[model samples]
Structures are given as structure tokens and as C-alpha cells.
Target: SSDLSDEDKIDQKGIRNSPYFKPDWSPELLSNGNYITHFCVYKNNVIEELKGFRGDYSGSQDYDLVLRATDKERKIEHISKILYGWRQILGSAALSTSSKPYAYNVAITALEDKIKRNGYDGKVQQITDTFFYRTKYEYGNPTVSIIMPVLEDLEILKKCILSIKKNTTHKSYEIIIVDHLHKKKELESILGNNCTIIKFDEKYQNSKVYNSGARVANGEYLLFLDPNLEIITNNWIESMLEVGFISKVGAVGCLLFNNNGQIYHAGKILGLDGICSNALEGRKHDNMYFGIANAIRNCSAVSGKCIMIKKNVFDSIDGWDENLFQYFNDVDLCLRIYESGYRVAYTPYVKLQKQNQITDDFSNEIDQRKLFIKKWKHVLEKPDPYYNENLSHVNGGYFLTSSPPLPRLMTLLLEVYYERIDLQTQFPEVAEGDYSNLLKWVINEGIINDSYMVTLAPFDKDFEILLQKYSQ
Candidate 1:
């Protein structure tokens, strides 16, 4: 048992929800290493291996030590239990980050050194004035062809093009707009001398329109964008290119927000209601749950509204499924891209604005969804590698489900059994002597259906008491 003062116990509640306690810590986790600085306990032997901390980095000595201690072979394990507490005394650096601003700089240095040691080709930069940092992957500049599909909304198209021209910092790019159906002179005027507008005199299909644009694209990469989108981040193109140019990455997507600043698309998760839905839809752009909304991670699919892929990769996949036409073509294309041995990644650094509308013609959308399910039935049956099993498929977001824990329940049972067997442990016996039955009852009643309940179950007193009681 560790000493936890009254104040420490109060602070531990907040720390438990942070990214530091996230389940795994791999090389990718280390690359984005700013979150692991607080409430950590390093072994005496591991500290000795790092030859103690440098006095020069006194303010961020713990951060430096943790970085040196964990490597690819010897990674850090995050225990959900709070075994220790941090006391924030007056004038202590922990009490106030402003007390020693030098620590921030040293922390950045430590991250840079760690990246070098791990052979990660990236640059670390402080995110605004905050202690949080972002790692930008470095790859040579490649010309990108932006393929935008539009109907006849010239005003919206003009805004989208203007935003891209004004906000985009990447220089090596060309815009190719696929004109579908209505041919407005305003669209031609909006195209100006910069863009190449191609006419498609056929039925409106997003996949075919994009494929038509891709055929004439000369750039090394293809950026499929919706003309209704307003670019929010100046570095959007640069950020997408950084991830898209990677050999292992098939496609990269940015966070998309509606006009009201609510999330429209963060990433696409498959098997949600037997089709694909945007991960973290209708949430704030910065809502950090399991660090999925904020961190760079692989996903099965991303919204084609604003996704980038290598020109060759698109060609290899034979472009999108023309049969999908309008809805779920992005999902179909992304799944094929994944099957073709390439990872699809979503990054929060680049964000865009668009007004998304769920189609009222449910029958047509449902028909397209059926075609999608028919094609990828095998994938829907399996667990999504990018998403956790505990998360719900009932909704688009990563909400927890009422499904029984199965293997996870076995681990929880072992923990409860060991606690009861330990004589010195303060752990109370099941109030009614049958903990297994209580767990079963709780699952049956749907008490642990959501993520909030599951996360707090181990520490929540009422929850623990409920688990201890036997059901009728």
C-alpha cells in the first residue's frame, strides 16, 4: 500500500481520466509523449539505469527520466489503480508550471532526444503556449492533386476554393474540380485561371466523379475534397501529406466540423449499424476520450469528403466502387485500401468546416448500405482493429455497449478472488458471498453498459458495493 494524502486522493480522480492511464504505451505512444509526465511511479532500479536525473533539467527531471526508462523492448505498463499520490506543496514546481518555465523547453529537448534514439523521423513542437506537444512526421514534399466534386452551388464552391487558396500553406498542389450535371458560368468564373474544371454529363455519382478527376491528375498524391467544405487549418494540406506520403499509409483524413463547431467527422468506424459512421460525430472537436479523437491512429475508414491518398495507391485499388454511387462509397474504398495492405490514419491537427446533412431519402441510402454490407459481410462480423471491443457499435461514436465482458470478466474475477484470499487486504468479501452471481446480475441489468460506468467500476465505492451484493 502507498501513502495517499487527502489532497492526493482528490487529484487522483482527474488523473485517472487522462491519457497517461491509457491502456498501452508503444513507440507511437512515446512519439506523442507529453501526457505521461504526471502521477507516475518509476522503479528505483530503472531510475538508477538512467543514472539519476540531470540537475540541468530539474524542473522536468521526471519527464526526462520516464522517457529514458521506456523503450520499444521495455515499454511502460499503465495500471488503472492509483497506488500512489503526489503532494503539491507550496512553491513546488508541481503546484505551478509558471514557477519554472525552463522545464517546458527541457521537456521538448527530452522528447527530441527520445525521437532520435528511437530512430523516429519527426519534429516536436509545443502546442501553442500549453505544456502539451505535437509530433509532426517529416517527409519530402510531394505534389498533391486536389480532386473536388461539385453540383451547381457556385457561391459555396467559391467559398471552398477561396478558403483553400487563402489558408493552404502547402505550395505544390493543383485543384481539379469535377463538374456534375448543372454547369453554371458562375462555377466557371469561380474556377478562374487557376483550376481545371472537367465536365461529367452523366448521373451524379461521387465515386465515378472522383475517378474521372484522378485520371487527369498529374500530382503524386490525390486529395478528394467536397467543394462545400471550408478549410479551417492553414496547415491542413501539409499535415495530410505528412501522413499520406508514408509508405504504409493508404489514406489520411482530417477532423471535420459543422458550421456550429460540432464534429461532423473525426474518423470512420466500420460495423456501426451494419454500415460505416464517423467516429466521435456530434462531439466537440477537442473531446479527448481514450485519446482517439486527438491522437494520430489507424482506422478502417475515413470520410472521403476530405481524404488524401497516394496517386498510385488509388490506381491500385481501381478507385472507389462505382456501384456505391453516393453513400458509403468512401467506406467501400477505404476497406479495399485496408485490404490492399495499407493503413488508413486520422489526425486531429488538420480540421475543416462543412455542413453535413443526413439524407432524408432513407430508402436509397438503405439500399446503398445493403450493397455495402453484402460486399463486406466478413469485415462486419470481425472486431474492428482500430476500435476497442468494449466500445458500442449501436452508435457512431465510441460509446460502451451492454455486451458481457467475456474474457475481460475472467480477469476481473481473478482480481476479486485474489483480494478476498489476501488476509491483510482491506478488500471486503462479496456482501452476499457470491461475487460471480452479482457480476452476472449487473451485466444482465445493463448497469455497466456505458463507458462511464466501466471506467469507474474499480474505484467507485457504490459500484464496488453493488458488485459485492448478491442479486435476488
Candidate 2:
């Protein structure tokens, strides 16, 4: 059913009447939970297989059926056109999700069943509302070694340590502070007998320092944290440990907030700006997008600033790439973890405040980015499965791209032509064919102007001509 108002219906066609109503009901998308509300079609056989909708879940019977139908390995089609009419009524379940509380309860059971069927060792818990839910993994209490790489910022480090001591509810955790050079007596006195400070004379390399701390870490889990972080959530360590101890989870990260309460680190997405940074940085930590910001979910990579990994999993990966000293070492390690068939998870429950900002030299960042790109070019080229393809790659925060591609041959041709660095370079995969004459004509005439004014007649005619050639 369309949620559009009367004004929306008059000014712009409602979703039911819009031409752009086609949706891809891929298994991956369905597994993340359904976002669509109406215009569903199902085969008689699939209906029979599901044994029809359960009468117990009267309000969400259709949703229950949909979940059950998707659970099986069967083909599901999304009709581009809305073929059914959804009459609006006073007490329609579509309009009022709260009318029937039993439906929401049953829905939770359905989702939990799906999780169990999928063989994931996690339980579903309702979020703020019963309509939305999140998964919580069950991992026994394991000793966690919190590794903090610190420089000379004693004040910030002291606050960080104090916050951990005061706020953290999780016991059986040890703090291993890797001191670089500025090992002050005050810092030692502050640490006292609580933390084991490892002094290193080598120049500051984030990866090397973490590796050094891990070498002496006796805990089952290794938590790599920055000295600037102040623990905000009481069960922060437990939250991270729960996800980290999952057999299939290689690494788990927490949501970090800046002084202004803006999101500092909330997992990460690879292939963004050649290297990777925090996904959805600068957004309010609680601002939910498709239930992502509010739930525990899998990601391609996560920030190392407050990430935890099982000791064995860390050892298996041989620790962080020291070559990627200052930057992208975390992303690289997470990528390796992904390649090794373990998922990287991010949970918003464990929130932390980062007091100090870690600034990197511009030139050094560029160099690090180049190294990261060179090593993971193939992964960069591929779409991040955890992230939506429609989202812009240029922005770390998931935003819709301006001037999205039109489903026209000329638009594709223009895109391919623009992608080419030089005339000699091969065209994009979409425009890969022998169009020597068209290329020559385009090169000679330059159909696309410097200011990108598309006089479409020439390109359109050339595309048709090429289409005719390819058709033969």
C-alpha cells in the first residue's frame, strides 16, 4: 500500500501508480528483511509450499508467508507494475502496525526461525519498536586484552583509562598500553598496577605497535583501541566480545562518536575514495538508515580504533599489515578476514567517545591510499556486497548519486566514452564491441562538449547504427 498523502497523489503519482515501481527482490535484500509494503504476487505452488498464511498472525499473515516463501530456494519475481488495489480502511493492518501487537510478536518468532534456519548462532531482539529488530550473538565470557596504542597525550590517555575503569561493566579484561616514546612518570603513575605498559623505542607505526601488544596479550580476544577513546557504554567490551567470539565473525567494531556527538567510526566500506574510511561518518550515531545504524549487521570492513577479534583469528591473519603502517591497515586486515570466510560485524550498541582527533599527513595518506588500492584493486572494482550498489562510491556516507544513469543507449555510450582515459583505451564492458567508425566519428566530431552539453542526435544515430551492426 502507498503511504503517500492526498497532496502527493495530486502532485506526484503515488508509489502504486508510479512507473518507477520496479524492485529487485534478491535473496540478499530479502535476508536483510523486507522494506516493501505492497503489490506482491505469489505462485499457487509457492503458496501451497508455505501451507498458506497462518491465521494466528492475521495482521501480518502476508509477511509471514513472504518470509517462509523466501526461506526456500525458489525464484521470486517482483512485478514492475502494481496489479492489485489496496483499499484504505480505518483499522487496516497496513496503516496501523500497532493495532495488532500479536502480529509483531509472531513476526519476531518468524525472523528468529529464519536466523536459526540460516545456521547463525544469534537471537533476534526487538529494537525501539516491535516492527524493527536486531540480532544478538551469544558468546561465553572470554578474557579480552584491550590494546591501546598511545603517544605523548597523557591527559587524554588518562581520561580514556579512567573511563574504562569507571564505565566498563565487563570484567576479565586487561589493558595493554603500547607506549611509543613520551613515557612520562605521570603516565606510569596513572596506569599504576592496572595496565601493563609496553615501551617501544621504534618510530610510531600503528600496526607494529598493535602487533607488539598482541604478542604479549594472553586474553582470548584482542581489542585494538586508540588512546583518544573514552568508553561511553557500560557493556561496551561485552557487546564487542559477544560479536567477536562468534565462530564465523573474524572481527567486530563499535560505533565511535566525536566530541560533537557526530559519528566518528561506524564500521567501514571498502573501495570508497580508493582506500576506505568510516562509513556514514559525521552522521548522528542514532540516525538509522534501513535499520543499519540501529542494528548489528555484517560489513566489508570496520575501523580498528575500537575493533575486537579472536586471538586465533588475529594470529591466522598474521596480524595487521605493517607495510600499511599509518593507514588502511585495519581495512586490509578486515578484507583478509573476509577472504578467509569470516564476517566482519558492526554493532551500534557499544558506543564510545573519541576525545582527540588523529590527523594524518596529506602526502602520507595519499601514499597509503595508493598502497591500499594497489593491493586490493580487484575487491575495489567489485561491488561491496554489504553496501548497496546504488549508493555513491565517492562518499563514505551512503548517499544517492546525482545524475544517475538513464536506461538509454546514448547514456551508456557517453558513460563508457567518459571512462576511457584515452581514445586508445578499451571501452567499458557495456560498450565493448567493434565500433571503429563510430569511434572515429566521435573523436573527429567530439559529440560531447567540454561543458558536457549532450547534443543527442549524433550519439543516438551512432548508437542505433552500432546496434544494427551488433544485431547482425
Candidate 3:
């Protein structure tokens, strides 16, 4: 294929192990750089709807058009078979984004237009010195109820309350602390006049406590927050509301890092490790997992730790399923939200420090998994749409397979794990948005073993030359 083409390399932006795009993977996953390569054959009507391309964004005319077209949820397909060659001529933005510097600026304008059209009051903040962006949406100042289930560490509860009071700029919110009936005196000492303590007589049950807090919540939106989380971003609540405001998006969650600063929760995958697992768990947030950890995207499930949703929508799902007890309660809640035709969403604009010192009181983990399996076996049986079917079970579930479904030079990077220096993350900034740095991070820690990194990697004369060009 490379011999047939003017260039000897595949499109770095589309160097994915899987050839298909997630249905409706736009506004969040879609950006100016990756996956917007030229030679796209579009339906005439779709092109006509966007008026083809604008002249104002000359360097990135197609990028602007694609952003505008996909803004309204148009289904896009990624055809794997190569249909044409792309010439990487000198001075072309494709060869080096710096060659046409105005392209990145035009891309920012294009993203801004997309955000404004979506009814969200947000500005697209470009990642400095890079073509990537993160949209910050303003909170409309609607009333929100903050539900804190106090199961452990009254000390952490104090920090959480203080963080909300100190960092959160949104004043139109009420903090409802659900806890043991006997701990009222102690809770009052910490919260004082800042929060309302709802003491219950029953033992600690996350589902029950969440439902109880929802029952008494008076705000239009309900934020199910764990008492162990400390807010870092000032506009955390507002940022989440940006995604929550999207049509058909039922629940919104934010990125939560553990005390050590590693990502513990960004979003949930239904079948990542087993039934479900955290997305990009234990990995740093900078440019990770197809940039999913930091991007505003649709996910299968969002964690209950920092999730926000409309009151009526939460009630529509009848709140959490009380039978599950502890683990997977959030996953089950998200699945039901999906069954009701609403997308569970996640955003990285909000960052929270997770305090994991406290231990949970519940111990019905085995039974809960059974309940989850019995209820959603139909959904779990399928591969997680947000994750690749060709990925490995290790390295946070973001590594390539030993024998990738579709092998390429990127597979050469897969043999080695994180033990070696990671070129993928380090080299992405080499050419910014040109897909060069993007390709380097593909194999990452999984480097080649022996003569082959990917056991099934092609070894023809052309393939060897391709390997020689990228082996380092």
C-alpha cells in the first residue's frame, strides 16, 4: 500500500488498532487534528448542508466543515481500505503544522462555533503550543443539590466541605450530608451552618443513602458527590454542567485523581477488566487513551463519585438500584440511564483529589456482582464501545495486543511496556497536530519482543523498510 502511495506511511492521525469509529464520536472525541485527513468521499447532501468549506479557514477549511457537520450528531464511518495516496509535500500543513501556523488558530475558531451552537456558554481554550483543546463551559447558576454520603473519615468530610466552600464559585448549591443518626453531633461540628446533615437509623448502604439524599434534594440538578473528594478546579461544577446541558446526556462526571496524583476515575467502561473498570485508571491525564481521560466525551458509564444530573432524569431512572448494595451501583445506574435513551457523559474540566484513606462499611461485593450480571448480562456480553477490542488487559487497558487485529508500524511500539521511555507521550509534541508525535505514542510501553514487536507484523521487503524507518 505504501509503495502504491506517494508517501510510505499511513495517516498518523488515524493510526488506531481498530478501524471503525464509535458511532456518534463527535464534539468530544472529534477534534481538528486526528481523523480529519483528506480524501474523504462524502454524500453530496451532507456536503451541501455545511456549504462545503469556508474560505476564512483556508488552511483548515475541511477541519472547520467536519466540525460543523458532526456538531449535530451525524453518523460517520471510517473505511479501512486505502482508496488514495496523500502527498506529504514540503510547506504543506500535512508535512508540518508549523508550515501553516494559521491553521491551529482557525481550528480554535471552528471549535468555538461548535460550542456556541450547542447552547452552551463556553470558550474553547487551546492547549498551549498544541493543536488540542479543552472547552470550558460556564455554569448557568441553576440550583444544584450536593449529596455527600458520609460513610467514613469525618476528617476528609471537613476538607470536602471546606473545598466546596473555598474553591466552588457557584453559590446556588446546598450540601446534604447523609450519615449515621448518632454522628449528627460530630457532623454538625465539622459542617456547622454550611451543610445540612441527614442522619439515618439504618446501616451504611450507598444506594439507600443516595436515594435518601435525592428524596430530600430541592435543587433542579443533583450532584452525587462522595465526601472523600476535594475540589481542585474553581469552575468544576460549572464545567460539568456544560456536558450535562447536552441533549440526551443523562449523567455527567469529572476526572478524579487519587492522593498520589494519578487518575483513579475519569469514566467507566462496562467490560474493561471484567464487568466494568475505570477508564485510564492509574495513568497520568496528559494526552492519554486516545486523549479520552482529558477530553469531553461520551462514555458508557460515569462514576457516582462526582456525577451530576437533572432531578427529573434521576427520578425517571428511579434513582440507584438499592439491591446491589455497594460495588457496581453506579455502573448499574448508568446502564439504566442508557436503556432510557440518555447518554452517560464525562468531562475533564473538573479535577478533584480523591482521599482513599477511609474504608467502606459495606461487604456484599460478591452478591452485588451477581445482581449486576443478572440484570445486565445482555449489555455486558458485548465489547465496551468506548474501548478497543484489540487492546491488552494490562497497562490500564490502553496497550496494544500481542497480535493486533490490524498490525502496522505502531504495533512495533506495543511489545515493550512502561518500563522503557515512552515515545508515544513524549513525541506527540514533536509536530503538534501533524500526527507524527501521535504515532510515536502508539506502541508505548509494549515494545517489540525479539525480531517482532507484533508477532504477526508483516516482514516483506517494503515492511522491513517501513520498520527501519520507525524502529527507534
Q: Candidates' lDDT values, in order?
A: 0.66, 0.66, 0.67
Poorest lDDT segment (10 consecutive residues) of candidate 2: 1-10
- TM-score for all predictions? 0.66, 0.71, 0.75
Query: Could you tell me which 10 consecutive residues in candidate 1 have the lowest summed lDDT?
Result: 1-10
User: lDDT-based ranking, best first?
Assistant: 3, 1, 2
Q: Per-residue CA lDDT of candidate 1, range 249-292, in tens?
A: 78988888877888888888664543457887877756455456
Q: Of 1 and 3, which scores higher on TM-score?
A: 3
Is 2 or 3 the stronger prediction by TM-score?
A: 3
For all candidates, what are the clash counts?
A: 0, 0, 11
Worst 10 residues of 3 by lDDT: 1-10
Quote the positional error of residue 76 for candidate 1 in Å.
12
> Which prediction has more favorable lDDT, 2 or 3?
3
Q: How does candidate 3 score on lDDT? A: 0.67
Candidate 2 — which residues are off by over 4 angstroms?
1-13, 16-96, 111-124, 135-138, 182-185, 192-194, 286-288, 394-396, 405-472
lDDT of 3 at 154: 77
